[model samples]
Target chain A: MKKYKILANEIIEFIIEKNLKRGYKLPKVNEFQQTFGYGKSTVLQALTLLDQQGIIYKVQGSGVFVRRNPGDLKEYVALTENLGFYSNNQNVKTRVLKLEELRLPPKWAVEKGLPASPCYSVKRIRIKEDGPFVIEHSYYSQQSVPYLSREIVEGSIFSYIRQALGKDIRFSEKYMHVVKLTDEQAEFLQLEENDPALEIKEVFSLSDGQIFDVSRLVYNYKNSKFFSQSSDEILS
Target chain B: MKKYKILANEIIEFIIEKNLKRGYKLPKVNEFQQTFGYGKSTVLQALTLLDQQGIIYKVQGSGVFVRRNPGDLKEYVALTENLGFYSNNQNVKTRVLKLEELRLPPKWAVEKGLPASPCYSVKRIRIKEDGPFVIEHSYYSQQSVPYLSREIVEGSIFSYIRQALGKDIRFSEKYMHVVKLTDEQAEFLQLEENDPALEIKEVFSLSDGQIFDVSRLVYNYKNSKFFSQSSDEILS
Candidate 1:
């Protein structure tokens, strides 16, 4: 068991020694195991740990690659396409909070860069996969999304917006920050007071530059992760 | 002072009562003071408080309004946008870790859904408006972004990429969760041992469906707030 960890560290050391660049592919897992004379499970465990450390990444059909420099503390993701689709088959538990139609005042208009219009508001909790992931609050412009109803919002709001309102979310500007969980947040997420969480704020804009929506996403960080790919300078 | 709070609450109440949606302009500051028989300072203080609560927003030349809700807590931008950009500008400070190009292993490739190719990586700490906003670690495909150097990463990595690589960021798929701060993370962010913080994982993709970047953004949420907007049904 210890040998496998040593082997994994050795692999990392080799990469560092060679000054290998990012995206450099590694040998096959079978080969690695064979070379190290380690069991598949041992190799897998070590690899998994390294992945968690943001050291390496695995490509499905392909092999693995060195992801970052040695002693790098930043987190990285290898894949980031085909997202934003909701699954109807999966059963996700939810708890609803405030839901209503709200008119935009000057304050909101300025924030959203909208021309001061009426909007809809919805707040809910979502639980899926490992645990409760996030508390979501959403707002929509009434003029843009006419005839929004409680029933429509009951299912997948993203689907409804796409199907009924014909709104296509092209891009979003996102801001991530850390926040101490409030009593309500902690209770809802089933954590103690002051448990840290990630707060994701985004503004969705259409391809034509119209600000369509804005939202705040709060998540439990212990069981979650984020992924992305960018140039070295961008990452710096 | 009590009257000021009352007047501010009254303004919010009026918006809700009248169903004034987002972007609905409020009366002028002078008008508010006259109507409520309050001093300008009092009225301004109340407005400022409301603004801070995100109950209202303001435009420089335009008046204030009740804030319109934007949907998708994970994608909302109102709170941070108003706070100001987290920049490495004069007011912001940055602590650079190590910067270098390195090869990613198969584990990272699989996570990124890549083909186990060579890649470049950079790591750094971003500090400016507040405490450490994020410790960024990034990985890039060498095939796409060649000629990346450590010197280039010391400044704004995003700017370097756009200027040097001509790569434009179109969208990103993000994952977020909460975690207790590790001794290292806590020390770096200047928090107590085991302080809770928000962790965000993301995969940034380009317009042509190319996976370009991945990052994990951690935020210190001790004194901060996070919010998201989504349809009510998603809560279920």
Candidate 2:
């Protein structure tokens, strides 16, 4: 292996092992060269190589720091167990568009195990600072678990269900499809009607296999990205 | 749980255990009723629920069939071990955009453990039957493994390496982000400039810890959806 390549690998291994988040400044060039006993050009080349990978950045006046874009598109694995829209990597905000009591259950309410009975229907728009990102239509079994207000809908529903309602988010089956946006959905997202969007539907069950909730999320194709990584899984 | 829900759960368990693929038709209504000894309403209600979840479909004047849509957008787990653009769910076509020799390796080539020298660079555009979808740029160490043709590139590179060249895929790491499309990328995809695009970067290593390959893929937002499900994991 080339000397500089070996040096680059060492630096990369260091960054990963350190578990450094973004904005972490690395040691100076001389410091790196002295510690690794590598020539100046070799160390410099290693740094340049890492920069090209978008792993770190070199400021004109300041030292090199880990590269972390504030507005970079993050993704959701869309796991049914993760029954909320929250990202510590970025600011996630939810707006309750419509909240009402459904006297007559929606025609397909039983899809998520909710019977033909009254339920709480909640509509929300999720934003991540850039703009409206996803519109969500969620249904909760009112008879089984009731007394949720609009305020609770604004925050993380998963946390609320677990911490407040004492419900367990066991697992879910999810289906994903791409479709043209409807007029109402487009208006909520301020996009052209019939524009492409990605839809994900999930039916979640509690520990005892009782229906907990059912939701369909429509993501604006313009700025949304979904990501997932696992040893045995497929992307999307 | 309601009687129909119990029926639905039993049907779901059967699907998973049977390992039914897309387009695998289920039993007829009378068949289901006789097999489970359930009433007509109970069986019909369970079918209705599965239809809502996009699992099955009814053919008028005929029996029900398993659901499969050709244009359904699919996602990747973005694992480096995935190593190719092939998907078992659909017919994926690859068109080589550019293939060249890197006289001077890209600065980040070594970051993926490639030596600081010449390498084979590949660019490809992947399309499903619906439309053009993802653009990929990949690099491999020329000396470590040589002799790749356009035909091999069109198909699965991982398959060729493992079956033809006798190499083992050890593991891979991936990074994902969402960003505005570059003018050139948008033009290639026939999309609007600055449209949202999902980018995934992967670095792979062989079983011997040698650098296998590094690639970056960009996907058009219009007809793309990613999905991942497992027993133990949550949404990111």
The lDDT of each candidate is 0.59, 0.66
Query: In model 2 chain B, where is the ten-residue run with the lowest total lDDT?
Result: B227-236
Candidate DockQ scores, in order: 0.12, 0.10
Instruction: Candidate 1: list runs displaced more than 4 Å.
Output: A1-90, A104-116, A206-209, A231-236, B1-177, B198-236
Tens-digit lDDT track of model 2 for A10-73: 8866877777755588899999988889999999988875654345666667788765332342
Per-model TM-score, in order, reads 0.46, 0.58
Q: What CAPRI grade goes to candidate 2?
A: incorrect
Q: How well is candidate 1 docked (DockQ)?
A: 0.12
Query: Highest lDDT: which candidate?
Result: 2
